[model samples]
Target: MTRRVLPYRTPSENVISAEDWHLVTPDGDIAAPEALPDWDYRMNLRLRRVVNVDLDRARTESGLPADAPLLLSAVWTATGSNLSGPAQHLRLPRAGTVPMKIDFELSGTNLGGLLLLDTALVLAERRPDARPASPRRAGSILWSDRRALRLQGDAPQFPMAVIDFSLTSFPDNAAWHLQISGSLESATMGALLLLVNERNTVTATAFANAAKPRQIDRLVLSAVYADAARLMVEHALSHEDFSEESDYPDDSLGATMLILFDRLFPDQSITDMRLRQRQSPSLFASDLQAAVTIFEVS
Candidate 1:
């Protein structure tokens, strides 16, 4: 394994010990897995972990004053939304081992793709009178660890909400609607939304119990997925810049659309598909329906 070499003297590898993160769920907390298929835009991710830091050893090895202050911090970044923020922060003891428990919660709307959690031990304040070859700057890293959780699943990943359709101009009976906005170059998180009407109990409940869907729920979800895929494909084809040669930013809507297009129509050229779509819209609809395999089980 490759290790980072810091500029100044640092604590040994055993200075910090951290437990694996746990995912909090309705049933109980489970060890966080490589991926969460049931996660949706409406859900929130709750995670917990414990960390133990040898503060006294850290200070002594780094040649710092005994009273030097330290900090333990956790920060999170979401690749899907291209957003990041602090999850938790704690002041470390000046001596002896310090055990800290961190409970972190993040909204699904602001998260997508991969969720990365970074925990670090750093100098809380600058020490001007520190010993030679020691870390003296504030926020100087002493040690750190990182964990990742994949948020993307089989479904088209995007933000979502459940509201009454009657509240707006939408038809009261409409089951669901995908609202896509902004330019293709815009961030995906701000570009797509899956809005489910609460009046449509079947559709709403399918998403609500997505983590543990029954057979009937699977059927409903399959239908929704098919329709949503159709809408996204049509939207992508409508744009002239959505071509194979077009390069979009990693987190852009165009990039997401390109991924969906490739998945739905692998080895198919965008130009050929676009021409077919324009010449025969109905045929295109049928083709998309077949590609999504609506109502089919895995």
Candidate 2:
């Protein structure tokens, strides 16, 4: 819950807001801090981002134990749109001593959509006196806080309790790295795996269609739909169980046309079904291509 701005690696662009930070330390074995997951270290950063036409991800950095095993995650939420995006996860190698990049992509061209991001990063090095224990489950949710990504759902709850997370940031050599660790019960882990697989399927389909069509409108439409699907999947996994059903748009082609309609005629209100009816197929095709400019990577 505590927040602090470090001396190194601050965003040059306008920062919206940042919070829900934690730091974890390696009590014994660096390779397996899973044993003593605690020992208090925490800090926070005031950072969050807004949707921009610019093609850069919000950037930040900190110094860590030159070469250490680490795990990092951020809760990315788009509020007004009712989309809780996934936790951007990264696993670092002991040999990686340079800065790492973390990215978040905006879905629709709706700059009005708001994004709130919360981060937790951890580094556990192997120690000479560390105790040997079975490895922690590989697919465990590292961020302990489930409250950050909660959403309203009508689905039934899981049969068992879900996992928990603990986060904090520790400093070494005058630099800091956020640390987070958590575990899940066997049933919860199984649910996570299932949800992850479903998300993968959804994303793979979008990518495939975007490539085959070779149309700007198709790519823009599929990209945003994929982003919304990703957000829903992230929201579902944020819970202890996998009962949450995502409500992303199933029709990327239709949604793209709608988005293009709004962008081309921002003065027009969606409530005007009459205006929508008047637009011909040729006009729709023209506007759709123009909207693709907003989604272009470069």
Q: 70-186 in candidate 2: lDDT tens per residue?
A: 455556554423345555666644442334344444332111122345554433343343223311233322222222322212111111111111221222121111111222222
Residue 245 CA error for candidate 2 (Å)?
Answer: 36
Tens digits of per-residue lDDT, candidate 1, 54-171, equal 8889888888889999988999998887789999999987788878898989988889878899988899999988777999999998988888888866567788889999997889
Q: Each prediction's TM-score against the native?
A: 0.79, 0.23
Clashes of 1: 0
Winner by lDDT: 1
RMSD of each: 3.7, 21.3
The 10 consecutive residues of candidate 1 with the worst lDDT sum are: 35-44
User: What's the C-alpha lDDT at position 143 in model 1?
Assistant: 88
